[model samples]
Target: MKLPNPFRKREYQILTPATKVDDSILERPEFLPEEEVKRSGKKTAAKQKKGKQLEGLISYLRKPRAEEGYTVLIAACIAILFTVFAFFGMIQAAGEPSLTVSAAVMSAMLVSAYGIYLAVRALRDKEKDQLYTWVGLSLSSLVMVTWVIALLLGLTT
Candidate 1:
């Protein structure tokens, strides 16, 4: 036993014989400190988000005509042609008069539906072509209502 003093020189007692420690772990980047690990995780997540945004923007720019209304226009044209065929068939029907009338009514309804589609698309994209948007909406609405009225009249007669 040693007598305790107010202070003594600091001494390290050997608890065990010295052994080799693997210093290779220190060179590994994964052995980062706690704060560095947290910061890296946040940075990686932010980078991923930025990459995804860039990918989306790149894909959008890749489209040939992102705002083309050609599909709606083609649908509208088909509806018009079908409507005319229906009328001609009904007026000069050699047989199946109802078929012609029904065809006409269906075509009219299709036109109305296409018009509504165009209108909604225009509004969604906030299109600068205001006149075209209004025309599509009004034309669809008018054609739809007119067909409905005609259908009722045809049934009554």
Candidate 2:
């Protein structure tokens, strides 16, 4: 029988012949010694530095405050007062009948238009204060419209 080939055997084996490696390839250079690296550590100088602060006196300017709520309240109140006045004026004008009726109607329409304009402006802007403004304006407009219509129909004064 023929002998089995050693290369074909299923077993671990060393392929290369043993030889001495060059010291330069196998070891770190002399300049990059472990002692010097350990002594230097990993600390950075930039991280240890402090930032600058403002030195001289400074003045800050602010804008004037707006009384949006007060404005809205005043507007609504004015519309209401005007409506009341118009109602009374119409009642007094009733004696003259045809003479002052058109004038009273025109005044009422104007007030109602102003209120509607305010309400529309407030509704278009999404700010919280403006939202409240719009609501107040809308309510005032509705009141004025209702009273004006009633007056024209001769239902109320």
Candidate 3:
């Protein structure tokens, strides 16, 4: 005769890389779905961070694997560098810029071209996220527009 105990639990098995699991025995009807099959929904911390980093700046870069994201990313990198350079140049010059306004305008225009290029690529692809492309385009267009306006107003010769 056997008596049932409410507190009794099945033995726990820990699986490691070296552990051998029996495939045939796993087909038995006693196991739960979770026990029979592992889960795939888990994500690594690195992948989560990468996805966050790509969200606003270059989410579509993974899909087409095109040059648009690369170019835009490069331009953004250069812009950050230019900002640092401009800051130091201004400090060295005691508020008067060592680089002429015209030189700055030219660099801005060149970088702005990359933005337009990315936008056009996004639009023409017809298979990518269009809104992100347009947003990126507008940012570059604004830069070019501001430069043009500055040139027209004689703010930068």
Highest TM-score scorer: 1
* 44-66: candidate 2 lDDT, tens digit per residue: 22223212223343434443222
lDDT of 1 by residue, 1-105 (tens): 988876888666688645454245653335767677586574465567679988866443333332324545455555666667776787787645776578676
Native-structure RMSD, model 1: 16.9
Q: For each candidate, C-alpha RMSD in Å?
A: 16.9, 18.6, 15.3
Which pairs clash (backbone N, Cα, C closer than 3 Å) in model 3? none
- TM-score of candidate 2 versus the correct structure, residues matched by position: 0.39
lDDT of each: 0.63, 0.55, 0.59
Tens-place lDDT per residue, model 3, 55-74, is 87944455554446556655
> Which number leads on lDDT?
1
Ranking by TM-score: 1, 3, 2
In candidate 2, position 98 carries an lDDT of 52
Q: What is the TM-score of each candidate against the true structure?
A: 0.45, 0.39, 0.43
lDDT of model number 2? 0.55
lDDT of 3 at 66: 47
